[model samples]
Target: MMSFDLIGRLFGSVRDRDGRADVLEKLAQHEPTLPAPRNPSAPEELLPVALATKVLAGWLANRQQTLVPHTLNFRVLGPAQADLLLAVMAAAIQADGEIDSREARQLSLALRRVGAGEDEARRIGAMLAEPQHLGTLLTRIQEADLATHAYAAALLAINRGTRVNRAFLDYVSARLGLVPDVAGSLERRYRA
Candidate 1:
């Protein structure tokens, strides 16, 4: 419920704007409402694979700019598609018994592009700096049979504005072998 509301507010500029330029400008300068990381750091160990996957999905969905400053032309990818890509990358990085420092750094930098301040980046870095924690995270994720389903739910939450469709939910549920009840719950909760 909180995420649903937050997602709407986060996209309010795009939804409320009458001009495409204004929408794009607002998106370029969008700031997160949550307490995000200021820098990449070892965070409170994110033990749950499902939860971490969800967060990763959200991060990818909200990506609006490159890490490099003064770069004008934003990517043409939609939030849903982008979220899927990030989930894939994150899943791969966490699959092995290691979380590559370079990848973590890249992810942190990418997050910073979305308005994570120095302190927040450091906090995020702390969350990711530990390979061992990442290993455990992956293990937990592999053990949770519903990780893929959880990821789909996160994606739905992020894309609730424009494309909340039954077809998407059914496809994700089938792919992840989610129970009908759980799939239905996610659809009900996340649909715009």
Candidate 2:
């Protein structure tokens, strides 16, 4: 989920480190080896990732930047988590029963550029059926962090003013067991 192109967009310094062309080139050149999922019961599971997020979140807060950007990296995601993100992104784009849009095209391009293969793309296309698919995706999210990430990704994918988009988000919030306040906070971050 942590697409280098995405990380490059959010963090200018990272993009600048090797030059823009080089950063995108890395995406095509190397498929990042995502680490296997950690034992959830263990306290130190993905400690570096958690710490890095905390640090970036803190740094962004200090600089008056929105928290949304730092939290969007899917690089640390395991297979199930990655699938969930792709599914939600596709669902949001298709929620209103219409999938033709610039957003849909952009997502397709991003997913491909990030090296999503034919299988995952097919799964995402199949998963746009709604309530059941959304429920199925939510179940794969065991960690609270993952649930939050998926919800955030959905929020980013959606056009909030659309009735179907709003409804899809409402269902996702309830199904994910995200409390109203936490859900509101996530929404507000994207709204900003």
Q: Which candidate tops lDDT? A: 2
The reply for model 1, stretches above 4 Å from the true place, is 1-143, 148-152, 160-166
lDDT of each: 0.43, 0.69
Against the true structure, candidate 2 has what lDDT? Answer: 0.69
Model 2: per-residue Cα lDDT over 1-192, one tens digit each: 667657756667444553457656766687777769756887677788799999888886654334334355555666777777877777677777776575566566655544566776787777665543555567776443577777877776656787778898998888888778678877877551
Please give the TM-score that candidate 1 achieves against the real structure. 0.23
| lDDT of candidate 2 at residue 72, scale 0 to 100 | 56
Error of 1 at 121 (Å): 9.0
Q: Where in model 2 is the C-alpha error above 4 Å?
A: 1-70, 105-132, 142-145
| Backbone clashes under 3 angstroms, per model | 22, 4
* lDDT digits (tens) for residues 32-75 of candidate 1: 46755566354555457568899788867643222211221114
